[model samples]
Target: MNRNYLLNDAIISPLGFTTSENLTSIRNSETALKLHRNSRYFKEGYYAGLIDLDWINSKFSRIGNPGKYTKLEKLIILAIKQVIDPSQNFSTRSSGLVLSTTKGNIDLLNNNDFSADRIYLWKMAQVIADFFELKQKPVVVSNACISGALAIKTANDFIESGRFKNAVVAGGDLVSDFVLSGFQSFQAISSKPCRPFSNDREGVSLGEAAAAIFIDQEQSAVGESVHYIDAVTANDANHISGPSRTGEGLYQSISRLFNNSGVDPSKVDYISAHGTATNFNDEMESISFNRAELNYVPVNSFKGYYGHTLGASALLETILTKKCLLNNELLASHNFTESGVSVNLNIIREHKRKELRTALKTASGFGGCNLAMLLQKQSL
Candidate 1:
């Protein structure tokens, strides 16, 4: 099987517009999550990580007409543009595009100017595909919060199967009224910035972000890069909204990946978990990690920094994990002050330097969906 190598990448979020900027902010223990009192989203207000629209328009004007695309489309285009090399001509026939989003242009439903068809997910995918002049039809992944990770897994499968030589995977979501209300109805929105896996942690703080990465079959020769080793997704059919009490699905996903790759669980140096700060999700992850014998691994959640970015969470977190592997640093789990889960975990409470070579990124979403991906630094 052809191995998939991670190439260039980009991130547009409240933290910064580029991947380097985002990583630097994280190294300094900075967070973009804040309290928003906007009545448009919720009458009682909520906490979220949101990008400044004015900044986005100013930056996007240099690339293309901002009026032609929606907010989410602009974010996706800007992210992917940073990954493409203008001097190198890409083969349209051998290239693929995969878009991941739980709600693509869902905010457009309230806008009167756009037609009803503008809200269609497939139509949004077409718009993104046309922007890059990609000849092949794009693949869309929208399986709840696991969409980002699943999209990358889909691209890996494509490259390994010889369906495409390379692929561009992009994901983004906005904290619009539609999204805010849905979570509000579930009483899942936290009153303040989220505190992942902390004793006093509340619920989730919704966030918005756009992230993109280029994956190719060939590895880069210039600097350190990570490659996809194995990935798996499992469903416990536990419930529609709640996770399995015993973490059955997540445990199964991690166990399968390790068993198939023959990689010992101890080899994993760091973990980027889906610690949403909610009682059930965080507790469930603790149970799952203990079951997989990963209790001693250094674990941290990016949600405290970016808030649960829904479809973009997994991909955005993956980019940071790649950076950590190359820089040999371990980022502290922002807002984690005290342990909250039942089983004890090696939670990273402070930023520190370490010799990181392997990482495990996990995500669990609604509909009983769970995903796990193993990544390793390329040996020189």
Candidate 2:
């Protein structure tokens, strides 16, 4: 196999914690988003996706130094334990760890006045490595929201380069006062959950989660076959924190994937957009689609299903996209009743039944970085 990034396997998310549980949730359109009334900003309350802390908490009463870890990291470490245990696959010979988090310990700092220097990025990576005894120094990617994609891409590189035989990339973040206050201060937190692409759109609701995937270069038959990271990380230096107004970065990234993979853009059946439901993000993404000649690709975002998990946001969405890619079933774009952006786009409404051979993922973040990853179906 001459493939660049082969995603030999993946697990499901949001619902049905296992791969089967998550697939059943999507097939039935059962949403994990709930009405969050206990938040500081929500005097009356708004809907959001929250992992059942108490439930999962009781299960992980044994992780050492759980107090030092942020709520997000705890959740992620627990999730990682579910997939990776020291007894079976934690050997230091071939396995490696890659951790993704935007506010690694920012939440901890906000909750307590800890020294900022103590919040070094390397510490977060070490926590996971020690927890599982993988012994390999983990690579941390914290490029704002694109951290998860970056981590996955980094893991792919490690495996392809023969540095490791199996690299587990885990993405996670928790809803904390630091992020909530920041979004609310910017007037971006929706009073209601959010109405992405709707005529009565407000803004995005903050969400928290931990999603992990095991990417082994060795092919497996049990998990669904969604090729992992076939194409990734085409950078665009367009803006400091927002998407390129003209989508040049997005265009270039998608173009690079197609050109390098020899897969025509026209062959792509659907797209999982960064659809944050914000005005600029939606508008700029539409323009990027047009510029990339992908205006026709049916686009959807799983953000509606799970607020946005900062570091885990892209990872959660990527896993969902992989599920859809394997099942030949696409998710509804959700919350798009009208086109608010400059260009009219194909927003998936009902579940799309298409032969999704290849699905393109487009994501941008603070510091003007754009990423396009083309994931392909398993060969027949």
Poorest 10 consecutive residues of model 2 by lDDT?
4-13
Evaluate model 1: give its lDDT. 0.89
Model 1 segments beyond 4 Å from truth? 40-44, 86-89
Highest lDDT scorer:
1
What value of lDDT does candidate 2 attain over all alpha carbons? 0.72
The TM-score between candidate 2 and the true structure equals 0.88
- True-structure RMSD for candidate 2: 3.1
Candidate 2 residue-wise lDDT, 1-380, digit = tens: 33433342233334645556666776676766678778677687766776676655554677655455555556777767766653243356568788888886676574454445536668766766776777677878888888887887888878778887777788777777777878777777677656566666677876767778777765555554767645556555766756777877777778887887788889888899888787777777888888888888888877776666678877777777887887788788765677788887888888867787788887877777778887877754
**Whole-model Cα lDDT of every candidate shown, in order:** 0.89, 0.72
Which 10-residue window in model 1 sums to the lowest lDDT? Answer: 85-94
lDDT of 1 by residue, 1-380 (tens): 55588778898899999999998888888888987888465676778999988889888899888888888989999998888753142466778888899999999987965668879988998998898788988999999998999999999998788777788899999998898888888988888899999999989999999999988877656667899888899997899899999999999999999998889998999999999999999999999999999999999999999999998999999988888898899999999988999998999999999999999999999999999999899775
